[model samples]
Target: MINSDEILKKLAIESNIRQEEIPDIDLYMDQVIQLFDSKFMKSLRNEEEKVLTKTMINNYAKGKLFIPIKNKKYSKEHIMLISMIYQLKGALSINDIKAILAPVNERIEKENFDLESFYSTLIELQQKNINNITDQIKIQEHEIEMLENDDQLKQILFISALSNMSNAFRKAAEILVDDLLENNKKKGDK
Candidate 1:
């Protein structure tokens, strides 16, 4: 039942931000939904693009890719999840990605994970991952250098995407809550 304006007001009050300073919550909501439509279609990278061969597309159609979503258009949540999948496409097998994301899906569904804290923790983890790469380079570790690079890059990109997705959801939620409060206030005055 959440909507955009309520989300905006909550964010404003919670963050001690002026109402005018907040972006348009409804517009943000639209952007969030559209984010998936534009982004998910571009899921396949140049290397992974080839993997979308006829057989692979057929496999996708046949549910080999675990199409939890049936509609051609997907929601922000769906896009966020798919983004994670795309990130793993290069490093992990399809089954492996599914296994890795299983716990995440469960956690999100069960509300076991705090979205805000998760985003913050991911940034810290990304920093740690970078530090590990730097330490390796400083030690003149040439072995697995390519792997280190790929790992670091993937971690950075994945965390960045996750952070953005979290923000989108948070903003949308805040706006929705704010709108409800405003409506209630107006009704009380009437």
Candidate 2:
């Protein structure tokens, strides 16, 4: 059986695409897809597990999760927005993303926000939290190891725990996101 620790180790080594790696110039649709896909290739489970796709991009725009495109190209800000949407969409709904990004998007469109700076700051904070993330994973691995007496049942119990934990995590995020949206709306009403 493949240990959960091994899996976590592999995930830790897989780095996400950094802001500096993103091209400064606006890119065509295909180029954008290729850039993300190639950069995230090592992290992908398989070729069929796409990092990004033209269809998904189009759907994001149609769903209003993405801001307006400039002419026929996607700017760096657009790239960052799309990237954020892509990650969020894995564990969140389109409505949730729309709610979360609405205020930030407004500031960007109003020329009061700088996407690059925002992205850099977010990256910095995320990096700061990496140790905590790794620590949590290690804690989980330790818990999994403690189940060694369960023999073949250990993996099943670990996976079930993961499922329950994911549901709990999602529920918490949904509630907090809804609360934030409500607070923002109340503030806007004033």
Candidate 3:
């Protein structure tokens, strides 16, 4: 049976793509796809798992879900945005992800903020409590260990908690993004 720890260990520090990991300059669509594909492969998942695809990247740009590309090349901002969408897509709807990134995209367009700073800060924040997260996971592992006979109950509880956590993050992100969007609009009106 597949265990969370095994899946998570494959993720390790490689899961979060550091700003230094990707090219600082713009990249072609295929380059973007290749990067994502290589990352997915590390989890030992099938190639057909479809983490990111050409059509999806095109669709994201068409939908303006992130900062659009320039001269057919995706900037660092684009990479960060795409990376985030890939991470969040599993837990949130496309529209929800769009809303979450809206403010950042606007700031990028206005030259008010660069994605390098934002992405770096975000990565740092996520890593700050990495140990705590691992501890929590170990606790969950112990709890599941104790309830081995009640596998169904454990699955239900774990999924419930996961869903709640996803919702909490989504709601908090929505508030910040919405506020940022509003402030930008108000500035434009002035």
**Top-scoring candidate (TM-score):** 2
Q: lDDT per residue, candidate 1, 1-190, as tens digits?
A: 2222332333221211122322343323344334433433333334343322335333433543433544444333443444445445644556555555555665766766653354445445645654554443333323333345676664554445445655675566456545655665687799
Each model's C-alpha lDDT?
0.44, 0.79, 0.76
Q: What is the lDDT of residue 168 in candidate 1?
A: 75
Q: Alpha-carbon error at 161 in model 3, in Å?
A: 5.3
What are the per-residue Cα lDDT tens digits for candidate 2 across 87-147? 6786789999989888788888887788788888877776776676567666666787776
Task: Return the lDDT, model 2, position 16.
Answer: 56
- For model 1, the stretches where C-alpha displacement exceeds 4 angstroms are 1-67, 109-120, 141-190
lDDT of 2: 0.79
Best by lDDT: 2
With a 3 Å backbone cut-off (N, CA, C), the pairs that clash in candidate 2 are: none
User: Of the candidates numbered 2 and 3, which has the greater TM-score value?
Assistant: 2
- TM-score (all chains, Cα) for each model: 0.36, 0.88, 0.76
Residues 57-126 of candidate 3 have per-residue lDDT tens digits of 9999998999767799987778889988887786667877887787678788886786888788888877
Candidate 1 TM-score, true structure as reference: 0.36
Candidate 3 runs further than 4 Å off? 1-4, 10-14, 44-46, 147-190
